[model samples]
Target chain A: MLKFNPRNYLKVTNGAVLLRAEIEKKMDEVSKKEFKNLFLIGSGGSIAIMYPFEYIWNSTSSIPAYAEIASEFMLQSHKQFDENSVVILSSLSGTTEETVEAAQYCKERGATTIGLVGEMDTPLANIVDYPIANYAENDYAADSINLQMYMIIFRLMHNNGEFAQYEQFVSELEKMPENLISVKEQTEEKAKEFADKYKDEDYHMLIGSGTAWGRTYAYSMCVLEEMQWIRTKSVHAAEFFHGTIELVERDTSIILLKGEDATRPLAERVERFAEKYTDKLTIFDTQDYTLDGISPEFRQYFPPLVLGSLLQRVSVHLENKRNHSLDKRRYYRTVAY
Target chain B: MLKFNPRNYLKVTNGAVLLRAEIEKKMDEVSKKEFKNLFLIGSGGSIAIMYPFEYIWNSTSSIPAYAEIASEFMLQSHKQFDENSVVILSSLSGTTEETVEAAQYCKERGATTIGLVGEMDTPLANIVDYPIANYAENDYAADSINLQMYMIIFRLMHNNGEFAQYEQFVSELEKMPENLISVKEQTEEKAKEFADKYKDEDYHMLIGSGTAWGRTYAYSMCVLEEMQWIRTKSVHAAEFFHGTIELVERDTSIILLKGEDATRPLAERVERFAEKYTDKLTIFDTQDYTLDGISPEFRQYFPPLVLGSLLQRVSVHLENKRNHSLDKRRYYRTVAY
Candidate 1:
């Protein structure tokens, strides 16, 4: 890996995974209190990262879950959110202003607040009732937060009697850090080739369905646009047919992210369409990556984490090939609005 | 008004409003029956149109509401949907494949299905339990659908005791067709100027908050990308500061859909930022249009409809200025994928 530190990545991710017991204890305490619903709140990539869990929670559990952008959520006056609501908020920097404000708002409303952050003692961490902290760099924050989220979300599900296989699932999740390392190593060459081939392409469309949709959205907006300053549109695979499909010319770049889930067929439909219409279609299928010791039944839940890890490699290669620093930004936190 | 037919637009929209008596009767009947939640299902622009109502419902009522992409909803097997669910679906053609399939799926699940469509004889109209039909063209469908949605959604909210001002609100809605004509007439020159100025621009970033977000997403994907083959990324105003703001430059085209809602301040924040960084900033504020008979208390609910009507003028001019037919499509319904 060009800029990736494998040892530090494992250390951070393992630390996140090691928080399982504490996370489970916290969730159990919250579960003992009768909560009505779950509000997954964050901003930008953090909010995108929650979408998969919202999808999973909606499909697998009777509890309703909403993934909302923090600032909008605060202003919307969501009627479903009340004293009994449970809120899960994530901020990698632990200093995202809107996220910190949302945490305080949730706390003031007497909602049980859970914060996922990259460091302790930060504003968000300080305000939230249950703060899960792990040290991670910008490159590895996704892996760390995702690892913690699995423990937190599934534990809540398990406590709710919705998931009976939580123990087995977490055991498989325990193997993910090493498996994800393999994913990076396996994807590095293809990522480099994709970067080299599309370095000069001005625009791209990224499509994903089910759990991979968040990664598709975040990678396009957060990495490609924000980091490399490239133009991109991320559409859901199911939505590609509605309006976006008409934009698919033979030379247009289309990226499809295929995950192992019930909505896999939606991505396949896009694949079939893109194959017929476009010459520059790239498919990143999680099924192609072998998670050596993971169970087949659990593969569906790993796409968000897998795709996040793999896309980091793509981001690194894109930055290297385009000679654009991933940290470069014209307005975000650099200039006041 | 370029290619707009005023009499037909009024006739179609008034017919939708005429359905108010029958729609209220149907909603009253359903209100007597017990339902758990709302599933607003559609595809493409149809799905995008449902988002505002979902936001409104979530903010105003305790009953949960979900705006789901039709195909993805069918595949996700959402646990919230069941016999107790009230499903609202819209398809102008009444034969959009995914929407039809979703209606069938909902019907099979024993959910109460409501279909809004252009004609009464199509598959969706035939399949749904309550079919509300009105004649509308591609350009005017937004107006027609939005008028009926106001009736249906507000009736539901009123029945839930969440909105006590339904009578006043619908009275104001009854005035919308003529008022929207004023909106189109008022916005024609500005729309033409915008189309002329941005005709050569290859890409644009559309931003909106609250109710306007749906219009932002739909106009960018449906009209600009699908109809004119221009590239666009429609981001929420609050989310703009998070990642996409980094893409803004002096020449970057930024279209802000400003609506008078609780989330208006979020859009204002984006405006402050975009004005500082981008010279090509376009703000379409619903407040600019005057609804002659509408009450001040009801202005918050008109943005979706007002913005829709105003943006239709923009679409007409964009098509004329770009020398592209809105109906022209290389893949959509022209050939098999």
Candidate 2:
């Protein structure tokens, strides 16, 4: 597990999961407000993490949800967003310039904002109406924020009478920190082979559908491009047929992150096509792991988290094989834009 | 212009404009229904074309709108869509497999469907409740559908009392066909220079914001990648700051599609950053054209159409300079998936 520590992963994830009671309490309190819709706002990986919840809300709940990029959200003046809207914003550093500005903008409009941050008293934490803090660094932040948001979003659904199985769902989510370790161990060999085989591959296509699409997007941008300076195109499985399919060559790497949602068939369609066209197809299906305590119906909702955890293993392996520091940056935060 | 006919452009666009009176009548009849939200469903370029209206609905109208990939939307069972939802589906051929299937799926759900197609008797046109027909080829379909959609969407807004300037806006839109020819004539030199300069380039970064984002995405995927076999990354201007900015180098080609919307500043920010990092920055600003008979306030809403018309000039040049036929397809519709 190149440069990995299981104990720290468990502790940080558990810290996020352990906030269930507090999250539920806050949701119960906020449920009394006349909020009409939910706005999930962030930037980069933080915003990408919100895409699955947006999908969940749209497919399973009657409530409307918008997952918007923070900088664009500010000037767009979304007509559905108002004083009665509930905005969920996340920034691990609590100092992402655009995210903090968005929080202040929402607060100025009298919207109730919930902040998920790495520590208390940061600008985002201070500006939001409800701040939930947990300590996690760059590598662990996506996993951590994802764990917290599941509680916050589902609790809102539960309070709204849209989800009756919240209690059981949270219990399964609580067991994830333990199960995630098994996923990493299981992925180690394949991940190592991938890192070694494609160390110098110039381009890769990462595809996914439903809940897995967010992680596919986040991994390509936040991890591959930002962390290792690798070039990648992350397309939704359905979108793959549009224009990207023509670019596939026999040796082109097509990585599919398959989830167990209703949209799995979409990814399956890509799998069937990719299997015929490219020999370098790699699939990381959530169904491969039983996920010990998670129920069959519930596993569909957890692929983003599962994919996120498994991809961390790939990132570590790539870092070692490519001799690239995941922390190295050519321009981001190196100088002001 | 190479391989372009101005008279046919005006005729095709004027035919779409002629539908305004009829489109308004249909909108009036449908507005009487108990629909609650909008479902914009399409595939590939058609779906990419819907992005701007989604932004328009969110920013300018209070009604909820969901723009989804036709194939994925059929499988996801979006809870927001029901008998009371209004769906808009478009396909140039009107036989696009996924789009036709999506129309059938929405029909089964009893949602009101409006189909914009190249002809009136195609499967999609037959499936939808309201079929708007215009004779348009691949090169002219985007412009035609955009003109028709402006009538359809704003009529809904006008009927909902959200837009009081509908009369003024539509009058300006009616004048677009002739004005569009002017844009083509104006863009000819620059478009040729761009196509000549970038004909041998392997990749491009197409950036846009607000109403112009859809054209940026469509040109990158539908024209550059699919039509010319060139690779491109179509990123929103705001999202560019998050991860894609790190990929910019002195030689990187950054093409910005600047629209006149509230999000213009966001694009400006990217322009500032790209100007500093890339020697190759191509900007297509809607403001460059003085659209006669159009009010200042109404011009902001027409960037998608303006950019669409302007990009046609670029596409024609690319086809000639790159020696690739725009009508040639390597996989799409040529073989079974």
Off by over 4 Å in 2: none
lDDT of 1 by residue, B307-330 (tens): 999999998998899899989998
Per-prediction fnat: 0.87, 0.66
Q: Indicate the docking level reached by candidate 1.
A: high
Off by over 4 Å in 1: none
Against the hidden reference, what TM-scores do the models get?
Answer: 0.99, 0.98
lDDT string for model 2 (B1-337, tens) is 7778988888899999999888998999889995799999887788878999999988888888989988778778888899999999998788988888999999999999999989988998999999989998767888899999999999999899999999989988999999888988899999999999999988888999889988888888878878887877788888887787777889999899999999999899999998888999999999999888888988888898889988989988988998998878878887678
Q: Per-residue error at B111 for model 1, in Å?
A: 0.6
Candidate 1 chain A, poorest ten consecutive residues by summed lDDT: A328-337
lDDT of each model, Cα atoms only?
A: 0.91, 0.89
